[model samples]
Target: MQFAGWLGMFAASTAVLAGCNGTDAADQSVAASQLAADECPSEGVALQVLGSGGPIAEAARAGTSYLLWIDGEPRLLIDAGAGSFLRFAEAGGNLATLDAILLTHLHADHAGDLAGILNSGGFEGRTDPLPVIGPDAAPRFPGTSEFLERLMSKEGGAFAYNGGYLDGTENKPLLRARDITTADGSGEASVLDISDDFSVTAHPVNHGVVPALGYVIEAGGKSVVITGDQSAASTLFAERLAATRPAILFAHHVINGEQGQPRGLHRTPSEIGELAGVMEPDQLVLTHNMNRSLSRIDDSRAAIGESYSGNISVAADLDCYPF
Candidate 1:
């Protein structure tokens, strides 16, 4: 029921942005009453699912994105699909301290709705530049910088009008893109950000020709690994993830394959089991949900349980995991 209200509020944000009729005072009242701040924690780490669905839309879940909160503040964002921005707001997170934005790849399902952050007046209370990191270019996908240029470059870009936002106009900070080397399945991992508080590492994983990479984010002695649409069967994934020893594995997956579509891009439940069995994370969270996967969650859990004896949870949109 809370998630249902979130979907409505997310829609309300879009309507409010799209010139929907309403008085400012009334909107503020409604927002204040409905979207009040939650009792966020003061320490440890919390993994919040802003979105959890697959390429297609589903009523139960949004797209693929996760928010990493430290000391009750959202500091790192992984992917920003279409519906995630609104979900971010609905989840009681603001962009005030979002320092890093990581992308697994340039697939629309993973990085599509980044415009919400770069929009001139879309958000509030943030003036710091955001560092967007992802894998280098590959056969079909655009590199991180190229991808941002296509989205917000001043000239001849998809969101050209967002130049003002990208340039930090009106005292707002710009959004910067930084491409990191994705270790080519050689058991090597590339460090994207390393600070005294937290560190992030990227490891290359096969997603057909998508130039994909998985991420390991660690802070405060708690860690979580996110596989953004990675192939569970890839040897590189096994090698890279096995090294970090993540506390939780947020792996993408589907229950069954479809006809006339390719299965090389995603992992089957068995494949996920194989990887999870090898990593043996303290907990395993099956994300990137789809209709089939949601319907057969028990079957999927049973299948993965065959290889893994760890705690497993199917993530729903807005689900929170504190560690």
Candidate 2:
């Protein structure tokens, strides 16, 4: 089925894009129609871009987040970045339908909306414990479980009033935060089975000093990989995922190239192309768009085209890509 209020969604999205991207009403309307046409199908595995931008507070985009739809139900949440709570609502999402929530890292842009989503879900009558998975602790970063405790713990959490999410009290469902230890110097990825139909494997990716993971999600006989803020300094992520030949590869496109941006944080456009060329995914979607990268879209596409010949798409908020 199509989304419940797709027309309203298009109007809101068009207004936001027109204001942020400096596009005219006609251009925004056409873009909105294109996104609407790619809406998730009712009986297949598809991906919905909840928040396609990076950490920046862009008017046209939210922070990085994605919803995996299976049989028309939102089954897996990849991240709940800033503004994703609203995007989820606009996309007609239901918390009761999610199987688990996966956080690639604890970055504010990637996990900022976690509590808000849980608070919203509390009123949705969901009783089963929801799983929140993320990377293990590093020198500066806390583990996934500790992060949740600090945010929702009854004792001294920032949002102690919402402690029911952690302790299963206050008439709210339980929230279980689990840490997945990615590969260290070794190249092996850590695997976790969420259900008979959904499984994920995490590989260590270089994101400055932050503990980050690149996830390869296996669902419904299809494989999809998301590289969260990875840099070209490390090749472990690409090496491990190339064999999977994922149906869709969501590569972060935060910077145009390695000139002004930090090389340890995000990959350059050429690096993204190299990764996509090695993996040979059926579709290569560039997400985590930032102002710098968005401004030079054609140049970035040309650079990526040097190494990859597959279809490359720049994702916008609420865009859907079925696999």
Candidate 3:
């Protein structure tokens, strides 16, 4: 999608921008100083869902992507999915002000627009280096370093023209990639201590060949767990959920039960409810909805409500929440 289209969409939606107060001069100054000092703030975090739809495309929602704004200025982008490049602009998130880009997994529905984001940053004349973090590379999909190498390696790469920036010769934005590794080597995952004010941890989950992950983000005295895409019955997921009590749980409602036939990977509404019940988050925000889940929105909410007493909200594209 074009940047113009995104700006148009943002201009058309008064509701999305209704609650956002433009950052005060002091806040902007703090954000700029933090960027220069490589420091992260410890309060006032906000989360926005850029693409809440699942693998299967939906007109109402895009794929799975989230924008987390910290201290009212610095933005952390998670999972740049197919339409997320446009959605980010539509959300009025400044790509130039982005602090970092974190990917849960290499699934196309999750990290498809990573290159597009880099390209957009270059186009916007951003000269600062941006950090890209994700799991180690596998045969199926490239890891963080390899992914960037393939883009700007200077040897038969897509964005080879920008290699001068990688060498610090030209005044182009540098793209840095960081691969997260697990401790036990059971699978690749890691807990990223972003700063004193915030942290993020990734746990391997069941998603067929995709090497899926779920993230736990902590900031501003609140925490949020985002389950990218996983099998509801996976015990690893339960173990991870048991470790922390998040303020909000953004779970996928894929609904994978059909006449007793087992679905490959992904959760059913009932399974999500059980997990939410175990985690006991303050609120449950269902996201990454497909037709199966969207058609049964009411049923999904009711099923989760049976197991969890907290507030339940079905996420939509560009949904905003204060954390």
Candidate 4:
């Protein structure tokens, strides 16, 4: 989709921006109670699906978002989609503790909640600059830094009032949006960040005409690979992460290879299975669920099970999978 159309649709679909402080005491208490019941375990390294649904609205799930919890803190975030603002709060995500934000692509379902997330983080008193890494610009897409400037630039941005993030002069912290080279065959995977706890690498992937990326996060002696929306035609992703042997592989399950489906934009069930067979992740988690794919989940499982004999799971919003 074109950038303008995506932005318009996202603006219409997303809820009004209301920070955590907007809630009343009783509402906060009830939310906290619910969070306690549905939150991920705080003792180990795990991935919490803050939004498991795709671009389309699904009452049971949110859009594509994830939070990586290490020990007890929310360390990293991936894809802050439309409804993830509330899910992030429910998952006990604290920007004060979060290390960075990694975006696969600038699609509405993948990054619509970015401004909301950054604006909400101000409430937590985060002063440190946060890195927002994403794919470089393509024909119809804006680069990571340009995307942020268009949204938060002080002079003329969609949310000009929130321009503090660009320079760190206002009450909010600085947000550094770095564009990673996503050209195929660009040497090895791009190492985005590394720290004492975890290291992250960005792998280039083909998502039709859009510049896209897949991520490999290594922490706690385990590896997790998140295959952002991509076609099955390319083997670069599999070839790059062949040795990683991820503990969990979160592959996008957006379409069935039906006759009229967009084969260049997404993987079919058979394609997912093929990648799983090669990667040999300990667990294969099918995420980015859309209505069409969800309707024929049995078929998807059957197809994937042919090549992959390991565990397969269909992710749901708020579901936590430990490594």
Candidate 5:
């Protein structure tokens, strides 16, 4: 089939020249399709990248967010970063059926669209309470509950008016924010949520002093671990996640080992490669790729590939993968 030009751009963009330190372009031609309209894989759990970019706004990519399609429904949304709602709209996901949202952190680029999502849902014809989960209050960060209160509470939340959706008659969103708190330094995996077919677990990951979390979404005999925007300064997190035997690791980091450079609490590629080597996941998808990683995709993949023999895929908005 002739590829659509936009898809060609997407496929081409994801490719890291194989000769560039042995990086592979193996999957580029499989399905070069528009991210906004791509269909989820029909079986197992399918994850679609809604926004693949990060903190800095970029015309070519939205912020960090993902949609999980289960039983053919886009029911779970992971992270609601800036402009994520637009991506969600373009992707044809039904807002009314969204089950829950898992926020890896409260960073503007990670959970910035929380209110936007709730506000938009106010018009999506949903009556059931929407669940929003995030980490507990840290020194400088507000927990999920506090954040929701400040956003939807009449007592000064910026969007208190949107809270009315929780009680409105039709086409309104009812929201419930759940905060997961594990004492800092505890590498224990805390259960954020559990269901018949799947469960979501979180553990602590180092991101400077911020109380951050890394999540594992387990379903259909498959596990996908998202390492939030964390550094691999410690081995506890990697060990905790490896125990899950993940099929995929959506690592949000890039390699910048130079000192005096602002690495912004993210891990370097070699660190990620080391972790992936131990986890031995079938695939290691490097995401939250910044300008550095974008310009040197092959280096990032090659650095990671040095230790991990698994397939390495650079994620782009709308790319879909099923477990």
Candidate 6:
């Protein structure tokens, strides 16, 4: 059954890539090449790249966001960066069915679309409060409660009138923000069990000037890890994630060189390779790409391949992986 399902998905993907919608053939080719079988599971897990770009907008890439559909429903959304809202709608995902959101950090590139999603839900007549999970914010930014208060506060907030929907007279979706606590000196890393079949754990990583994080998601017996933004050598995070034997690792390529220099926040291509090697995942996916990294994809892959023998791929916008 799994093999048959795999064949069907492959065929469907091929059809989508064959100029079905009058899209540029080159664009379809790029999307098809990035799609991977390992990331897609036949049972019930589906991974969709809503926006695979970086903080800066690119004609080809849309900020940073990933959607995981379980049993054909939006189970989890990881990061809602700059343009992810449009991508989410274009993909036909029902925002009303979203179970929760996991944010890796407070970077504009990663969490910039939160307000947009809230506004969209209001327009769609959704009244239930949506749960948002992220690292603790008081010392950093603002915890979930304060984040919403500032956004929808009636007094000195951005969307003062937006609070009317949450009063129960009309259908207003609530934003339930939950803080994830990290270990002292280790940064806050905690596990969020959304359901019996789905659970996610976060680990703190280095993304200079901000409290950054990475997540390891376990669903349908498959484990997937996403490194939000970190310097290459995160011994603590790597050691914890290594135990999961993730099927796929969505690692960000931000930093380029050593740890403590000016670029102390992001990971270099070689560092990403080392992380993949330690985790030993079935596949390694590099994303959050910038112009410099995108130009050296081959070199990045080669660097990571030296330490990791698993499948390596560079993700693009709207790329789908079935798991």
**Which is the leading candidate under lDDT?**
2
Off by over 4 Å in 4: 1-38, 184-188, 257-260
lDDT of 4: 0.80
Q: Give me the runs in candidate 2 sitting further than 4 Å from their true place.
A: 1-37, 183-188
Best by TM-score: 2
lDDT per residue, candidate 5, 1-323, as tens digits?
A: 01223445665556534325455444333323334235576566888777888888764467899888887777889988888877777665666777788888888888888788777767667777777777888888999888887887766778877756544434566567777764553556788653566788877777766677888888877888888878665457887666455888888755544231345577778778888888888888877766666676667777887888889887777677788
Query: Which prediction has more favorable TM-score, 2 or 6?
Result: 2
Question: How would you encode candidate 4's per-residue C-alpha lDDT over 1-323 as one tens digit per residue?
Answer: 12223333443333222233463445334333322323556588888888888999866467899899888788999999898887787677878887889999999999999889888887777778988899899788998899999999998999999898899877777887889877642425788754678999888888887888898888878999999998875578887777567899999998864442778888888889989999999999999987789889999999888889999988877778788
Total backbone clashes of candidate 5, pairs 3 or more residues apart or in separate chains? 2
Clashes of 4: 0
Give TM-scores for every candidate, taking all chains together and pairing residue i with residue i: 0.82, 0.90, 0.79, 0.86, 0.84, 0.82
lDDT of 6 by residue, 1-323 (tens): 23323533674587576777777767555544533223334358877777777877765566889888777676788988888887676555555878788887776778788778767877777666677787666466775556667777767668877875335335776666777664321765677767676888878776655666788888878988888877654668887776567888888875443332335677777778788888888888778876666766777777777888889877766666765
Tell me the lDDT of model 1 at 68. Answer: 83
Clashing pairs in 4: none
Q: CA lDDT of each candidate?
A: 0.72, 0.81, 0.69, 0.80, 0.72, 0.71
Q: Candidate 1: misplaced stretches above 4 Å? A: 1-42, 120-125, 183-188, 257-261
Runs in model 3 deviating more than 4 A are 1-43, 164-169, 182-189, 256-262
- lDDT tens digits, residue span 87-200, model 2: 888777878988888898889889999889888988888888888888888787898999999998899999999888887877787887788775442335778767676788
| lDDT tens readout by residue for model 1, 1-323 | 14435555665575466444554545444443323223335577788877878888765466898888777777888888867877777666656677788888887777877777456233473667777788788767788988887777788788777665567765556777777665443435777663556888887777776777888888778788887776654687686567456789998866463221246777777778878888878999988887777667777787788888889987767777776
RMSD of each: 7.0, 3.1, 9.4, 8.9, 6.3, 5.5
Reference-based TM-score, model 3? 0.79
Candidate achieving higher TM-score, 1 or 4: 4
What would you estimate as the lDDT of candidate 5? Answer: 0.72
